[model samples]
Target: MKKDKFLFLLSKKLSNDISVEENELLTLAINTSDEYKQLADKLTKYFNQRKAKNSKTDKLRAAWTMIAKAEEENFEGTFDYAAPKSKFNIFSFLKIAAVLILALASTLVVYTLQKRSQQEIQSFNTGTTKSFKLLADGTKIWLNKNSELSYNSSFGKEKREISLQGEAYFDVVKNSAIPLFIHVGNITIEVKGTAFNVNAYSGKPYIQVALIRGLIQVSHTSDPENRILLKPNQKLIIPKALVQGNTSKFDIEPISTLDLLNETKWTSDTLIFRKEKLKDLAIRLEKKYELKIEIQSAQLKERRFSGTFTTETIKQALDGLKLSYPLTYTISNKLVIIKD
Candidate 1:
């Protein structure tokens, strides 16, 4: 039942003989697997209850003895052990166990609810400009235009977690004791010291994560049972509607040079677009240039364009777009109008 492996680690931890590495492995096992976590939790309460009752090792021995005796009696069907009577009442023990189980169940339900709605939230928003932020955990984030990032004040103390809207590039520091979690809509990306780009702008068709370095585990909040581990230079895309019935929809692909550039160049104030639609490009151009762009021709809005803009003015960038695409644009004050 894999109890031996768990028992060995539990025994070491209880005896205070477990090394740091063994303790980390034990923690990882409990955190990653629901089975291990539940088993550990149950056994922990068992030992705590025994200790609280001032019971000795004989009580534990007797519990196992009762189980073994019951099994043997079932097998032999004619065994009897009517010797000396003990003070241990199985019925009373069952009542105590029931109460403990109910208490633990109640606690778990409360915890699950509280984890969703945390207080003392700290939020940052990048409006029409890219910005840099350094978290308390030493993680560096480059938030793209029109993006917002928020985390609880309990961050770095109890848990390291943040929620993101729009796009951002994260350079997370290594902290095995407290792994970082990024919540983008329904998808959650677990990071253990990695650099990644997350694009999850509202109203977008999909959410994407591009792992530039290290590793990350991506899972949907609706489909926790399904997960995808992404390595360096790998990208994962999850549909906006991540869950349909019990099915989880996602795609994992290797990142190309152009793809990586397009995903992360915005962090450095460089906008890179590849086969991007004029309508989609307009949104980014509006954010980067902080102006209104109106496409008068419906046909021109669907046209695709590819280019990079770093130190270009709004007029210069639009002129560059017109070079490859058959389009004309006029700038008046802060408004830019594009025509076919």
Candidate 2:
């Protein structure tokens, strides 16, 4: 059997589209001839190599050329001028080969174009209210509302690197040699097989690192001397530092995991607070829910509340808040104004 025919039959079988007769034919072909087995192995190797190389255009072109050459050779051997010619002659064989090549090449060209268009690098703006996911290497990353994640074509390799502007929860895949590196403001976090959350937006006053599971190492990209290793259920706070005369410094402090998880509840689309001041909790609510929350009374801002709320509508959340504090709120578009 020709390589193209074998590939067609193999693809049909793999896709579960082969008829019972075609399946039996394929089985007999493979068992009777070592050549057919070799061709199947070659096609499998080609596909595996294409995936490993990660260059779709080059691989598609190479695959089309190989298939065309194999078909031409197969046609030359299958037909004989000295043999009696039936309704199907050399012209029919050439026509079939040409049609197969044209169809395969056209299909591959369209597929390559579509894939390239979809894989283009895109940047997102979280203008006070946006949530997105950064998916790579079977890992799930939930970017908090008002947070931004930027990346280009060079993603997910020996070293997967991403720059963060706000807060995000990461479920990083396990690869000891190729660690996931996150660049947040001036700090850099290196981890291998871990789940953590990072909040380092420019508008924010402090850089926070919360490790939910696994181990992670956080260090200043500018000042290597400032390094901290965090274990599971540990948190670090990097105080906001000014860049004066090209000299910079940061103050690092450790916090409890319970507090960290409360801050990171956005990952689960839940908000939890424990006797947290209405003022302090308002800041977090705005960031997590991607809404603008304002406290009109300075004294009311100091009032504390304790409760947990799911990622519900702004109205419902505010109602829950009102139940705990003597406050009134009004929602206008994305802004939530509050007063006591």
Candidate 3:
């Protein structure tokens, strides 16, 4: 089916007036057709949203009205009830009904399409590793290595909200009216236009939010009563203990503002570390390269390393680690094994 025609049929389906046969036809059409996948996805989002907001009766009535309008506008004078030759066959009736339904359904169909254009605003993990750019308003977010970010299509009007798992750097466009909000694990960071880095891996013990510029407010999404206001060059650490309710709030300790420059060096395609521990460094390297790294000895994990690594292959990262500690690493495919 043509894009326009598929959209028309989708509108009829939404209207509750589609016959059982028509519904089956639409299912088959959408299933076998790749050209109409975009249209089908949009229709699915619209129907899901409508179902979320309206009661069953209201939805049914709205659909009935849509079908009635389509029938009236498309088949008005075309049908000759008294002419024997003009009497409708099943195929003729279906064709005429489709045309009329499509014409009447255009307005609603357009509205649904527009609303769902950004419906894929949230992309989940596709197993291995993937990267995507989120064009928010004028601000552009280059989602780092293994992270995922999601938001509703209708964001930024009331409150700009996004959920993050893993790490991402934000170059937020200055907008005072709508403050950008990021929810990672239990913590929420609110900011306007600012540049910042967030490391909030799900498996990790702590969530870290570092601000390079502008003011941001960080708080626990679950415990709204607790909050922390961060200034430029400030870093907030929500240790696993604190996040698990072992403590009420994260510790208020100031990290060297210089660390912000190193932490975000990945944005420039470089990995820089200053006096970071081997274990901590491994966590970052895993996320950066999307590989699994394991340290065999507990003693080896605590050794601190400090160096600046340019964008190099995983071998270079391992070599950099070897230079800092008396450890040997074996690489097999995507897995890195460390032995001492």
Candidate 4:
């Protein structure tokens, strides 16, 4: 219903007189959404038919606003129009996506889709909160705080590929023909059916892929020929190219940490760290609680500790951390300052 108005507007803007820039935007929206003429032709006819209706201009604008919301929710499947023959409008589909990738605007849409994925890239961002999703392939993906996952709706059809940021645990359904491929920046983790935890924070200087069950292959974009295969109970970390230097902030090896279950414990609403550096632990806590953490002393940041906490309060987490490390913290709004 709302999408119709968006398509109607696009068609009207193209047929009628509109600003040159607006026309260019609509044209780009159409091209970006889909290249299939059959789908586009059906949508063009639908738009033309709807344009003749006595719809107010505000109604069209309202539909444009709804596009952003629909994009946020990533409403699955196509709209059920009154005309069963009418297909989903390519322009409207791409316009909302364009908004999301451009600046959380359409540019946000472009940024997410510009170089990666084919067409039809849908993104899920878990900002300061964990999120769960039953993907198109029936795979259960649990994204940790401050994470993102983007995949096209036709994920299970020809290919099962998804781009990831931050951390996510996947319980993938076994699909031999269409093996799943996870894209984290330059590296790709290929798996057919497996349960694993992947930590690839955009800011973190390392990427870790820990396998719980099944097998996975980790490869880098720079070195396509040399790929590392990981077995069960193992983790693979790719040292990121830092602006400062070649050194990674964390270990760059595929080591198991069952003693702490350090990778996927957040899925159970628990934060557990076994001998993790104060700086790394601080970063994880900040993301888990959605707060800014400032450690006063550089020396204190190097302290290693082991702890577990399921507390909903940041102070409680801090208290648990203090048991092992000599640290005091002050909370000011969304910021936490820790001092030695």
Ranked candidates, highest lDDT first: 1, 3, 4, 2
Query: Where does candidate 1 stray beyond 4 Å?
Result: 1-118, 244-248, 270-340
Worst 10 residues of 1 by lDDT: 98-107
Model 2 CA deviation exceeding 4 Å by range = 1-121, 128-130, 223-226, 242-257, 270-340
Candidate 3 per-residue lDDT over residues 129-218, each given as its tens digit: 333343435454645666777775545544577888888888787779988888887777888888888888778888888888888888
Give each model's whole-structure lDDT. Answer: 0.73, 0.65, 0.67, 0.66
Q: How displaced is residue 71 in candidate 2, in Å?
A: 24
**236 in model 3: Cα distance from truth in Å?**
0.8
Question: What total of clashing residue pairs does each candidate reach?
Answer: 0, 0, 1, 13
Query: Candidate 1: global Cα-lDDT?
Result: 0.73
TM-scores of the models, in the order given: 0.45, 0.45, 0.45, 0.43
lDDT (Cα, tens digit) per residue for candidate 1, span 1-340: 1334555676556434467656655664564333356556765665567656645444644565565576667736544556665799764575355434434543464355346544667787878877766565557788888999998655665689899999999999898999998999887889989899999999899898898989999876766667778998888888887664333467888988788988887776667675688999999999999999999988888887665665678988888786666688888999999998
lDDT of 1 at 40: 67
Clashing pairs in 2: none
For lDDT, the strongest prediction is 1
Q: In model 4, which regions exceed 4 Å deviation?
A: 1-118, 242-257, 270-340
State the TM-score for model 1. Answer: 0.45
Candidate 2 lDDT tens digits, 165-233: 888888887877767788887778888889888888788788888888899887778765566788876
Query: lDDT tens digits, residues 1-340, model 4?
Result: 1223334445445334355544443443443233222233554555456556736433544566676577676754655555465477764775554333222222232334333544577787878877666564557788888998888755676788789989999999999999998998777788999999888887887777788888888776565555667788776767776222222332435455673277788887656565688899988888888889999899998887664544458988788666555688899999999999
TM-score of 4: 0.43
